[model samples]
Target chain A: MANTMLHINHIAKTFNPGTITEKKALLDVELTLNEGDFVTVIGGNGAGKSTMLNAVAGVFPVDSGKIEIGGVDVTHLPEYKRAKYLGRVFQDPMTGTAATMNIEENMALAMRRGQPRGLKWGIRPMEREMYREQLRTLGLGLEDRMQSKVGLLSGGQRQALTLLMATLKTPKLLLLDEHTAALDPKTAAKVLELTEKIVAEQKLTAMMVTHNMKDAIAIGNRLIMMNAGRIVVDVSGERKKNLTRAEVMGLFEKAAGEELDGDRLLLS
Target chain B: MEIIKLINALPGCVSQGVIWGIMAIGVYITYRILDVADLTVDGSIATGGAVATVLLMAGVNPWIALIVAFVVGMLTGLATGIFHTFMGIPAILAGILTQLSLYSVNLAILGKANLPLNATKLELLISQRNVRALSLDNPLIVLAIVTAGVIALLYLFFGTELGCSLRATGANNAMARAQGINTNTNKVLGLMLSNGLVALSGALLCQYQGFTDVGMGRGAIVIGLAAVIIGEVLFSKIFNNFALKLLAVSIGAVIYFVVIQVVLWLGLDTDFLKMLQALVVAVFLAIPYWKGKYFNKKTGKGA
Candidate 1:
């Protein structure tokens, strides 16, 4: 068996399809990730990078095609229903976690994601120790402040907490939609380091979308570049490790058959 | 002394307060927890009273009649929920639609504008006649126990997994859905729960007052909002626990009724009471908004 963890089959999506402002956001996109494969995605503005992530996350229905996670088809699943099989962290720090809830409570919710919630107490006494231990791994001294509301935390701390919540249950597929983009550079590096540690330790299959070319090149086992609703370039393993920004730009120009002039894709 | 007369009427005020307090708690669930200003209570309260009064007239047990009223109130919430979620109507408009439709429904249930439960013929749980009666028959004692029970049950329920998800849905729908909770379903469930409690309180009120009128619930949402706001303003600092917060709401309702009785005793025209209440609630509601806008200036100058 191929043991593919995520398979996006010829997916297509459009925004305001019948209007003058209609934009085809995704165009017959296909991708497959095997177990332990961490893929980084890069694209410029108006590209389909975030749309592809949204499509997989089921933020809205794709116009056509199917998606499968761990061999189970989820094309028709609503966002919440699909959440059972995937862990998603959004670009906005405020998007990923409930700010009004305490840290332990947020973790408890993630721990039971996809499980049928019943009348049982949301956070059992025994789960506290486990939550503390998990928070300790963040190295933010958050373990001691488990009862603090998440809203009191800084943007960086909230993003880190959101990352922990996403991975706490060991989801079959993890989707990162520029999860670190809202942080200071220092915090971004720290969050990315934590991301690497968790994914490596758990051997999680993940796809991360980023605007930073260097970060995209450096973070994952595989790299794919999207443009105008299609993946234009893909590289993996030894070839991906040695790739440089200039060469990647050259590859984009050659594949896209145009000068790489989008100001949104940060070469630095 | 005027104060002495107000003191003499305190027990009656407390009994009425106890009944309205339960209704206010129901409003709290939707207004505070579910974050929707559900107008269903205005109609559902009367629906509850109508059902209970009609059933009691038919010689049904008061306890069973209360449950039936609660179930009917839940149906009103269900209608509003379906209107909002399934039909894609805005939550406020959906509630208004339910409230409007429930006018005819309440009338149909009672077969008139009002129905009276004769205390001598009907077996009642609590009655205004016994409000001054210092015994187990007193409506105050029964209502107090019932309020305490409700507060205890609500405390336990909110601590549960399902309840937490419902709270999360109110707090943040985006996050709730991302965690695999169906926000629409939770919204509907919350409305149902809120309206159910409102109806139960209505049933109790009907029996206590010995009558159910179609117009009994007019301006009821304001009363519920007044109770909630007053409770938060006065007891929020002291009541940190969820259960204590609910208790504060009950206390708030008591204070509200006591204040009204004082106003009545003070010889203020009774016609102006509703306007006075509207102004009081409006001012209180404005305080937080004003604090955020003007008092908390970024320059840190004293207001």
Candidate 2:
């Protein structure tokens, strides 16, 4: 039996509770991922896709549910403490890496994730060879410019570096929140390919949130559709592999009781 | 107008600048590395002097007095850190509050507004009386060795795993947290380290000048900033290494004092020196913003 890597039980989150601007971002969301389960999450604007991911990452406290990663209860743990169990990539490239630091330094930071940072040197001489090998896999020529500041890189390069950094330690779970959404079409496709390659090579359990509908159907072994604040459609195995865009939309409309209203979703 | 008079004052100005260079380095940690405009230095510098002077008067070893001043300075930073991080106050306001309260604290330590250190009777670490001397007692020689030691230690610290996390915390708070670094803890640690150095500088300054005054550190933030900006503007391109960057800051302090001396020699009133320092810093600080706004080449609109 596959071990459960992530267990999010009946979690709910509300932003600015009791205020006029209060928005219910997540409502009774529940999810469980087995080891090596690559799940793709899709939703319209204001849906709870990102909120659910953030809850799992411990970005904010859930109002009334427990989150466990690798069988460890972490519902009340702060973001930094919970970071030990997960790797995260944000939508904006700039949000994932320190611009002022060099590529090797950024990777060195990620390499030490979940470990106590002591008085030891940040990057050992031997570690530089490892970083160089990893950068070579990205094929962006970053290995030659290890000393170059990350601020000098383009958006796609930064996103690729972020992906490498996120999975550098083989995280128990990876959370990608529309990481390629900010890149141009060609760059986005490249990053998506890299993400798929890395996920499979590491045999890592991962959750990816994407705005592209085709990517949702094409990339992961399982597909989950969310509407409002709940999961509406879930399909995996042979059923998920054969899922078409129109059928997914039909399932969403039937479960949600409304036609999808997101123009960006439709156009993409 | 006399060239010989101006030449005679150069050594004194260099010694004062070197001492303040240590304080400016403290500013660089908070301002440049930690990305905080910590105003706590304004009061903590005097707090260092007060603590050191009092200890020296009690027949304590000068080095031990300096160490105590450094520790007290770190305590002041811890107070500001608690206010900013634990209590959720804005960093600037937290610094200001600590600085304001430190005034009373400094006065209490000295038990008066000013305390004089009779250098002839007490064995001092560094004194202006020997600034021009070629012997080991010369303030410049001692200051040079001290400043180099500081730069070497800081370079090593910043290379450590803990130090990199502090730099990441300043460079990008969001990214730092994602990498499992406790950013609040790092911020507090950085503030403490910065203020400890500032207080050490204050101790040295008091001993060198033979007195500690409550108002001696007035406008210190401006002078520190001037030194930092001057250093960056002059040596940023060439001094990319961490140790060299710190060295540039010390050199920048020397240049700042040299400029002030030149102005004074040009018959400028000593009272206007503060105004002059403020203006110079303000102008240097604004140059980057103005260049980014006005000097960029116009790129065509995106497709």
lDDT (Cα, 0-100) at A179 in candidate 1: 94
lDDT of 2 by residue, B42-73 (tens): 99999999999999999999989988999999
- What candidate 2 gets wrong by more than 4 Å, as runs, is A262-267, B300-303
lDDT of 1 by residue, B1-303 (tens): 467888889999999988999999999999999999999899999999999999999999888998899899999999999999999999999999999999999999999998999998999999998877878999988798889988999999989999999988998888899899999999999999999989999999999999999889888888999999999999998888889888888888889999898888989899998898888889989999998887568557753
DockQ of each: 0.80, 0.89
Model 1, total clashes: 0
Task: Enumerate clash totals for all models, in the order shown.
Answer: 0, 0
Worst 10 residues of 2 chain A by lDDT: A259-268
Candidate 1, DockQ score (0 to 1) = 0.80
Task: Supply candidate 2's per-residue lDDT for B34.
Answer: 91
Grade the docking of candidate 2. Answer: high
Task: Write out the backbone clash pairs for model 2.
Answer: none
lDDT of each: 0.91, 0.93
Q: Please estimate how well model 2 matches the true structure, expressed as its whole-model Cα lDDT.
A: 0.93
- For residues A131-226, could you state the per-residue lDDT of candidate 2 as single tens digits? 999999999999999999999999999999999999999899999999989999999999999999999999999999988999999998999988
